[model samples]
Target: MWSLWGLLLCEALLPIVVISVQVLSKVGDTVLLVAECPPGFQVREAIWRSLWPSEELLATLFRGSLETLYHSRFLGRVQLHSNLSLELGPLKTGDSGNFSVLMVDTGGQTWTQTLNLKVYGAVPKPMVQVFTAATEEAQPPNTCQIFLSCWAPNMSDITYSWRREGTINVDVELHSLFSNGQVLSVSLGLGDKDVAYTCIASNPVSWDMATVIPWESCHHESASGKASYKDVLLVVIPISLFLILAGLFGAWHHGPCSGTNYLSVPDDF
Candidate 1:
């Protein structure tokens, strides 16, 4: 009688064992693997062995079991749950590989499913650059024409515009607004005066703007001819005064000598 009861109990537990093993499955970013155990049996431990393991299994397995006896050698492993979801955080290029999930039953039965994992890395940031006209020597009036431009290293599809400093005016006179960037040129007239100007470049991904001011553009030549005339008058006035003094001295000395000779001649008569 006891033997018959034992046989009946074994039969009842068989279906449970099968159901437990069938429910083991997981979804991951890089890989998808499913593990199953018998219905009546629970997973005592889970193990994963990878041909090229990125991180140690002991460190990667947070919630699930990682026992030596239950551990299985696979490219990837995931824990079994009612709704199995494995979020392989921030995947790298090297994370791509074949993966499998191993679930060990209390009765020592193991089940595993193989999956192929493809990892995709995130895109890199775009490179930005500022372009401008050539720098020239400082002229007398310090005036020159300026050109502003912007570009990206690897990206071709971009948009650009120009902005001026301390003004509400937007510049629309661009030489060329290419698929990559834009170029703007303006005739900057400068003197000794101080002023400011700016250029702005932008795109969908990023924006870069630069400002420049040729302060010498505002200079005006103060009436230079009037200054030259005043200098000439200063030199001529001093020379005229010296000539008048010399003539007066010669006349005075000769007049005295002539008067003395006339008086002596009258005495002889």
Candidate 2:
């Protein structure tokens, strides 16, 4: 019984040098890999290597030095930090791999750790497109409702969301209402008060948003209101002036101080 337990323990402890790490990155960005060492032990040497996509030796360093000797393709893009960490960057999609580091302690014992890196491209701002049945539906409508779609060009691994007035809630999807991850439709009759729509696009590296409204149509409404006011003034002003002139003429003809005796010399002339 003890023999089986001992064999299991030896097998489990053997090749246990690997400590795996996971990370996500974008192109033209940096990724760092770290090796943890127990305190009070001086590192005599350190070596970083890539295991997946090919076994390539990437770097080696000695104590009391700052520079890391790197592979030919990795030159000028890798650096060593004080805490026994390696930084590789302005990354590329091909840089995704399993990175390992081996350390030699003061007494010359060897140990290692590994990292798994995954890379993606950065996402740009989303462009929102809206559609409606009404003519000139380009703008948001106070009378009707619409459909909206968001597009993030030249990007992958993206997700989408819809919002209104900067608030997110279950009601955002409930007003005669419904929304897909990237598309949405709503109606004004629902009394939803969602004056505007916003689309948010996201990826592992970044996220952005765009908003739309029908204010141009509202602008036309304001102009119409101003035109109506001008029309009312045009009619009312002439009518008011005519009334004033007629009143003056009637008073001159019928008032107590009429034309008969006000200027007595006019009859002699």
Candidate 3:
């Protein structure tokens, strides 16, 4: 009779030990699961496993899957195995979320565990680039309308302004400001002949500037009939005199009449 009682006690304790072991072994995201087993029989086949959420939500928001999010194969559909650990890469504001793991055992058991990953970091500084016409080429004349442009990578929304170093009137019209910090076109009407112009571009985070010197009008007066006659006389007279003097000097230096010896005159004719 005592042996029968001992056997009953052992049987009750065995189920409790098995349940405790199974619960302790479960370490990852807990999944709620249902186990189908024989009635009145202790079942050890049913176990809790970790669940990995489908990357659909992450893909919808960030346009990438979990593998791309973590930058490693650490957070997707991990089987229940020993030493199960997840390594997430550099986290961003988009990475913060409540993630769950769903598990299903062979005995029709299902369970889930939720994990809230909090990610924090700074956003990278925007790449800035200033653009304008090459300096080697002749720019448009200042008298006519001229355009100056500035650009930045990944930025479209920008503001543009024109400034001069010296006193000069500048007529400007802002054409377009993009959403990503870029200046499309800026027109300037400059009347002054010798004026320096500067185009400045600014955004919420940074700013850039470009300087340009437009082609100027020639200051020389136009040639007229009277002016042409005067110019010809002024140049031709000096050149003609110089050539005459040079010819005379050469003849005197090398001619028979040259030197101190005089021509012999006949004593008797």
Q: What would the per-residue lDDT of candidate 2 be over residues 160-267, giving only the tens digit for each residue?
A: 877776454646666433344787765543254336777888887778999887343334555777899999999999987877776666556566664554422222
lDDT of 3: 0.38
All candidates' lDDT scores? 0.42, 0.68, 0.38
Q: Under the 3 Å rule for N, CA and C atoms, how many clashes does model 2 have?
A: 1
How well is each residue in 142-241 modelled by candidate 1, as lDDT tens digits? Answer: 3445444544344333455555555455454543444434555554453313345444444432345555553332221223445777888999888777
lDDT of 2: 0.68
Off by over 4 Å in 3: 1-143, 168-191, 216-269
Q: What's the residue-level lDDT of 91 in candidate 3?
A: 35
Instruction: List the candidates ranked by lDDT, beginning with the highest.
Output: 2, 1, 3
Better of 2 and 3 by lDDT: 2
State which candidate has the highest lDDT. 2
Q: Give the per-residue Cα lDDT of candidate 1 at 263.
A: 20
When summed lDDT is taken over every stretch of 10 residues in candidate 2, the lowest stretch is: 260-269
- Encode model 3's per-residue lDDT on 1-269: one tens digit a residue: 35223333433444332221111111133322122222443322222222233342211001111222322223453222221223333333344444433322234233333455543332223333333332223556532333334443443445656565466353443244454333434333445456555656654444667665542312211224458879999999998787777666655655666567643332321
